[model samples]
Target chain A: MNTKILRNLAFTIFTCYVTIAVSETPHWSHDEQSTWWAIQDTTQNVPLNYPFGECGIGKHQSPVDLASATIIDSKSLNKLAALYDTDTAPVFFNSGHGIQVNTSEDYSGVLMIGEESFPLIQFHFHEPSEHVVGGKSFPAELHYVHINEDGRIIVLAVAVDIGEENPVFGTILDNIPHEEGGQNASSGIQINPAELLPADLDPANLDYYTVAGSLTTPPCSEGVQWYLLPKVITISAAQLVQLKDIYTNNARAPQNLNGRSLLSTQ
Target chain B: MLIKLFLAVSLSLSVASCFAESDGNKSKSLIDPSQQKRLSTDSSQQKQAAQPNASTKSTDSQSPQNSNQENKPSMIDFCRKNPC
Candidate 1:
């Protein structure tokens, strides 16, 4: 081989190796959740430790059982306020874990919990809800994930029950991509996040069960403020079946409260 | 020299192919039989928990008209009325 050609070939090989090693991250799956923390990166022909080891040792985890919560007077606390645009063309994707809807870059929905306001990042669905209310689990749960300027996460959760068919939820179900990692972005399909809630529940005077917890998914990053609405929204049994067919049993089991205070709004 | 270049390209393609295969396999192996059983058990437990009881109210109150009333029941009311 020509000397220069051989040198370039060697460089190309080295670059490919480096790129593959750098891009390959540890994979975590719900099937083997017990071994999530031990998931290895074998791209470099070596088992590298999982980067997000918090899943194994987080003190304050999420999806805590609300049955054991202590109700506190929320008269002094500011009412829950949601300022969402009625016409948002969101991109719905199947994340393998659940059906997640991502808002557009210009989407300006804001959720106000007390005085603090967080920007709505995205929302997702989980079947057989993560939070157990009064020792009972709902048919499903909807988590609206938000983040503030300081990177604080506030997840507003709504319990889903089997009742009347929600047109908005039906629209979401109809548009959601079935395959994992598949995304459906239809500009014609508009959704109002507020409509996903019970029509009668006032956004300003919303009552919820608030607790300090962490993300339910892998990495299980702590310090997330969770506000779960006790009042549930309904979907028809057929709608529930549609949702379950997409992603059943995606919810993480409830974690220990660990001395955390579960407060309720008035 | 041409043979040497061919070998080099083949090796690179094989490396890329291996990584792609690994990625595909990771997703395919997500839900095994044990995970399916666990999912079933979780569903059964959820069904049992969802049964009606004195502590829990009927889903009828979730209606638009009922929930919009001035004296709409709050989580506090539920906690106070029940032993939760």
Candidate 2:
């Protein structure tokens, strides 16, 4: 090989090494959830780890820019409450959306209250949703998180996208009780919140995507019950802004298989 | 060796299921540390199977309203009167 060519290759290798080391420096300082500490110096807390090793790792790592993917619009989303033997009845509560069914129990979408739980506490939405499908990221992913009495969370992630304005999402966006940065935003809007759901709901249409996930908040705990709907919902960019900050990126990038099974309920 | 490999994969799967179960359990608790601590008691673990069994029926049942509210009368004790 010519000495000049060899020298050029060596320089290229050197540049790659430098780039890697620089990238790694930010990650090394992150917490177990891979989030950098909330320091005053940092302007916006973005994931230093671009692609996480696990399927879900960071707390604020939500799915973003949702206009790209194709989602199946099934009728099942409408009847989710009826399937779990639930009352699409809405119960009022202090915080969160959806309805509080029979007592304080309520969550967004239809939640099946189980035995080994803190009982399903509530369901809510994060604007622009979270979770990505295949390699395509959606605008929003609604998380139907179930909590047992133990305070453990099993979050079923449903990815939403941008499309024609649906009445269900409109209800949610319209009645949203607490605006994120607003003075009155302490709690979410409460209504017979089940109305904000897609009609003709089919859990089967929701192809389950699972992986080890962490909370989207501090102390980002791993081992979450993640269910990603194969079908994405359409949400206008404007409607999404009403839920929460689209820029916060409240979702973890997909985690590694780590030899994990991504089960589909269908 | 192939059999052993199969067994190994099976073992990993079992372990993953346990992880999923635990993760599933964690979904509700991730909101608050105090809420989680309340759930970590030995009594709650005992209720684990009972809970999913109850929830699974609700989860898979075609009638979303009829799934698990069978014990609704007792839930009043749970909601307003209890720590919920």
Candidate 3:
């Protein structure tokens, strides 16, 4: 055999293996829908897709159209109290769905619900805005997840639109890994969750819609407390496009309100 | 010269045989059982339903405690499009 021919043959075989090894495997559910395509497969899996399906039969599902609800007097609504620390380093994970930033144990940030307080756990983003307001879905949504002592979850969701570049989101998005399933840790940089919100967002003056719903993802567990802030945060077009490239069309369609009341402050 | 030609033909045939075998088994290996099981486990974990707290539940229902519990991946693993 010619030495060059032998070498070429080996190289071709090696290339084949490498290509296959690097390719991502599709993750399918029993209903034959995957997280990547499940939102769009709604027409097929009515039982398993958005609005219904899972361990719980989607009674009060999240990502609902906020515009459909009635607005109450803002003063009558209970004020949200957040004691977020200004000094702390948060670690970010890709989580395949969006960039998940985990709060460290020592962060001491907590969202107070009257007497019961839930510590800030983590926050992630969903593009094209999961919850629709005024018959329009924004470019993105940010969810700040917290948990009480009993393992109950409450999510503080903020809707985002493209306008100006968000400095905090800019810092986070700059370190995002191009490859899926990759996480990067911020070194020597401390980030306060407060920085993620608008500087003018006063908790006392803010009007938000409160609802009881299930987790947007699988397990689709119920009993999650949700508060959707009415104010829209702005992100740059480039930042939105960068995030979209990572998880194109990642937003889950708004679920049926299911006779659920969407209460908000005026 | 005939011997050399025969040697080249034989080498070409061997290379073609290797390619054929890999091609035949590629699909089967791609769906390896271990990988399937891992995916199955993830889907199975989604079966754990959250205790229903009817939509009427209010935030002030529970008394405030200085709870500082750390967050774990107790909920289903989150990814945007691809498998996490």
Off by over 4 Å in 2: A1-34, A37-110, A113-118, A127-129, A177-198, A203-207, A241-248, B1-84
Which has the higher TM-score value, candidate number 2 or candidate number 3? 3
Model 3: pairs clashing at backbone N, Cα or C within 3 Å: A74-A266, A96-B79, A96-B80, A97-B79, A97-B80, A115-B63, A115-B64, A116-B63, A116-B64
lDDT, model 3, position B63: 16
Report interface Cα RMSD per prediction: 18.3, 16.5, 18.9
TM-score of each: 0.69, 0.43, 0.63
- Per-residue CA lDDT of model 3 for B1-84, tens digit only, reads 999999999999999999998654321111122212111224243333222233334332211122233323333222222211
Error of 3 at A264 (Å): 2.2
RMSD of 2: 23.9
DockQ, every prediction:
0.01, 0.02, 0.01
Question: What is candidate 2's lDDT per residue for B1-84, written digit by digit as tens?
Answer: 999999999999999999888644322111122211111234333322222222332211111112234434443332322112
Residue A193 miss distance in model 1 (angstroms): 0.8
Docking class of 3: incorrect
lDDT by residue (tens digit), candidate 1, A1-266? 69999999999999998887765445556667666666665554433345446666776777877655444432233468877776556877677678877776577888976566777767888898888755568888888877655555668888887877889888888888888768787747888798886565687677665666767876576656677775677788999999988888887787776666544443
Which ten contiguous residues of candidate 3 chain A have the minimum total lDDT? A24-33
lDDT string, candidate 3, A1-266, tens digits: 69999999999999987676433333333233234333332223454444324423555666677656433332234557666775466766677666767776567888765555777877888877778755567788888888755566778888777777888888777766766567666555577887666445675344455767766765455667787765667788999988887766666677777666554443
